[model samples]
Target: MFRIPASNNGLYLGSVPQSAAAKNGGTLITLDHDMATLPAVGRTLTVAELAEHVDDMAGRLWAAGIRPSERVAVHMSPGFDIYVLATAVARIGAVPVMLSPALEGESVAALLERLDRPHLLTDGAKLDGPLADFPVADLTDRTVVATGSRPGAVSLDDLAGAPRQQPVLLHPDEPALMTHTSGTTGLPKLVVHSARTLRGRFRPQERLASLVRKRETVAIHVSYVHSRMYLALAVLLPRAMPLVIMNDSEPAGVAELFAETRPGFIETHPNSFMEWEELVDHPRRPLANVRYFSTTFDAIHPSTMDRLLRASERRAPLFFQIYGQSECGPLVGRGYTRKNAHKADGRCLGFAMPGVTNFRLVSRNGARPSRDTPGYIEVSTAGRALTYFGEGERFDQQVHGGWWRGGDVGYRSGYGCLHLLDREVDVIPTIHSTLEVEDTVLGRLEELTELVVVAGPDQEPVPVVCTRNDRPLEAERWRAAVADLTPMAEPVQMPLTELPRTATMKIKRIELSQRLRTQEGRAS
Candidate 1:
């Protein structure tokens, strides 16, 4: 048996460190400057006080019949309130089911059903406006816990007044958080992660001591509902002070927050950083105090990395290009330092981190593995998820002998770096018999900002390009560019304002294909 680490000394999901700023009387700032920052906003809560509040909230939830292992859905926007609610659920050894407020009603209802008897904690206004129309009650034995007053719901403020009690201790392998994927392919899968898995991914033993000693102030720009939430709670919370941004995530707002908070570390999606790049025009502020900047959840464009390196005033190391699916924690990451930053072949998604994780590439034809050959990426991790909520077939196909096939296709370079290609389903096959048309095209069109090559309605290849320049490309110029590749790519080029992206910023090829089909039908 793989022995799980003790929760006392090692970082555990849902438990904040006794040495945290919230405990040391350093305030937790919710960046909501538009509205008056509350007394709780700037005033620090000591670790003891924060624990007391969590205990009180947990006891009330328990009184209301919440039990350990029960899934409690938190449906609020980013804020301190979300932090409190999530921690409260964790205190009682229950799993917090996190969902973005932006998700459609149908998706929300489906997720609730999959989680089972989910206690919905949401904004009261949303419930009355759209959520109420859904079959929320039928999905689960859900009681509406509202942040603000609305009809047919209990106020979250009332729960705080309940008696305080010691929180239940959880085993390291116990499920702590349920984070859903973006569901771009189909229904979103509920990824259940244990305390140990969460820690392994976030608080690697190598960085644990430094984090604790420094007591760094960490800023998280992604939504708290993401898998990164567990990382924040398990790893960063135990070591650093957290700055939570409440308003919509705009690049300007994020830049302003960075200026105000001056955190030592920042964790966010690559797209967020990219969007922020547009807003930040002035010379980069000296982030001398900032120790690390981590990007995850989506592909980091090479151009974005270049811009960040150029814009950074303090010249801190570009920490990691994290790669992992929701089912598994961060499987791989690579640090890009100044010495190796400009090495030409773009950024490599580094090797595997220590702990019980292994990776292999399975070929499309089920052939044996070959070095430098592209194949479906599969990972075997000590922390692999148990099962999908309802999709047994998907669960079975992907999971084999403890290894999960990540549906993505990629190759390991001679330098041992992983270079991810497009998804297996998205691979465009042409009559020219070249399986690598997409890669060839992408390699040739490196100057283009964004490109998606897909099979058009007639099964002919089409290229959709989103350029930095607004002007449309001349047809002759586009044809001449791909002239070398003849009948293989009879490319129909279209200019798009911006590529439609999923929440994670992956190009939605299926949606793009549908749009192309609609256009083709109209033309016909």
Candidate 2:
């Protein structure tokens, strides 16, 4: 369904930059922060330069003994280098397992064990900080440090003059990359992806990218470990779009970068966009040149969408909200303009991509699914991950007849708009959709930077709030805002930093709920 030439062949992460460089060596890529691996290379580079760095890193890995088809887990210090390193691992024909830097040391060690002692690529910061208490030596086959040296670890710097090896291309169906789930329940699961499967995830996004008639700089601030980041590069690089990779999400830093870069296309996690709401009024008009604002992680608040859309001076600026999961790529989405964003229903996520994707709501009870009684939201797409590495049975439970049922409960509107209500695990007896309540209250109270509703110790719907700048939340204002909505527990105001978050900035609802329960237990 996509006209992009790169889509014809499988979207192989290993060869993406090389192919792009071959097509257009001059395509500019600007980064907000310096790369960890290439510390002296500076922040800006051409497509050719990036490909060269990837090739050099691949040679380094080859010297380090990472061979074709072997698994290499990448859990290193934060930077844009993670993607480059993962790509380097892929170039050598080994699957790059992406473990988010935000993952706890325990979780990382556990995931390393799950990979059956895969080679680990990390940095000394992690070795000395979060991982200081864990016996990392017992969890992996070999430890390769990308930066700094640790005893019993191979350093990439030591192999600077290693001979370059030809890029290895595995079978389209062979595992090429692995990323973990958000781990809201427990340790994250390793999601396995192949060249062909990654291509599946690329097509819909390719079609979306095709919508941009003119070449404008595309700025992206997504988790370095996410499949979306790779797919986004697959779409942008081959097309030779000028790219800006953002490492900072702070409002002031983002303002300076966006103002200086003047990116026309911007994409980030929904929560990041919410955090950027303050940028709307920046004197420099940081978002003025933006024509498209896109987010794929979760349903964003209408207010946040409206503010960003209005900030753009471009004619017909659009905010695209794509509802998707880690396992299945972009499933359904619709764009909103300033004219309609304020009135848009937070629950009514858009329609599925025609031909490329399809969704079905399986009944929770004997009756058919509807607004009141949401059902299991399952999707059938080529973009679905192959399987959970080393957890085949757990993966099997979610698949039925080629349909992947992510643990989400939602219904479809009469007009076929998918309405996401709540995750099955986060559902409370007192509320139909915790997310809907959050969206409503957040839109009503401008002071709120974030809001989440989780099941309290008594199964009561508790609303957890984080105000802008961590200011005290006015009791009367909050009461007035939720007056017309469902009854909720007393608001628990906390610093935004205290809320548990995934790499992509998604709130760990289950973790937050567990903390609430623990606090209640202590009080009693």
Candidate 1: give the clashing pairs. Answer: 22-45, 23-46, 23-47, 27-44
lDDT of 2 by residue, 252-367 (tens): 99999999999999999988998999998999999999999999988899999999999999999998889888998999999999899999999888999999999999999977
TM value for model 1: 0.82
| Number of the top-ranking candidate, with TM-score as the measure | 2
Q: Output the worst ten-in-a-row residue range by lDDT, candidate 1.
A: 32-41
lDDT agreement with native, every candidate: 0.62, 0.91
Candidate 1 per-residue lDDT over residues 325-402, each given as its tens digit: 778867777766545544424425767766646687778776654433468788877556656666667778988676
**Stretches of candidate 1 exceeding 4 Å from the true structure:** 1-12, 17-53, 203-217, 241-247, 283-291, 338-347, 366-373, 430-450, 459-461, 467-500
The local lDDT score (0 to 100) that residue 112 gets in candidate 1 is 85
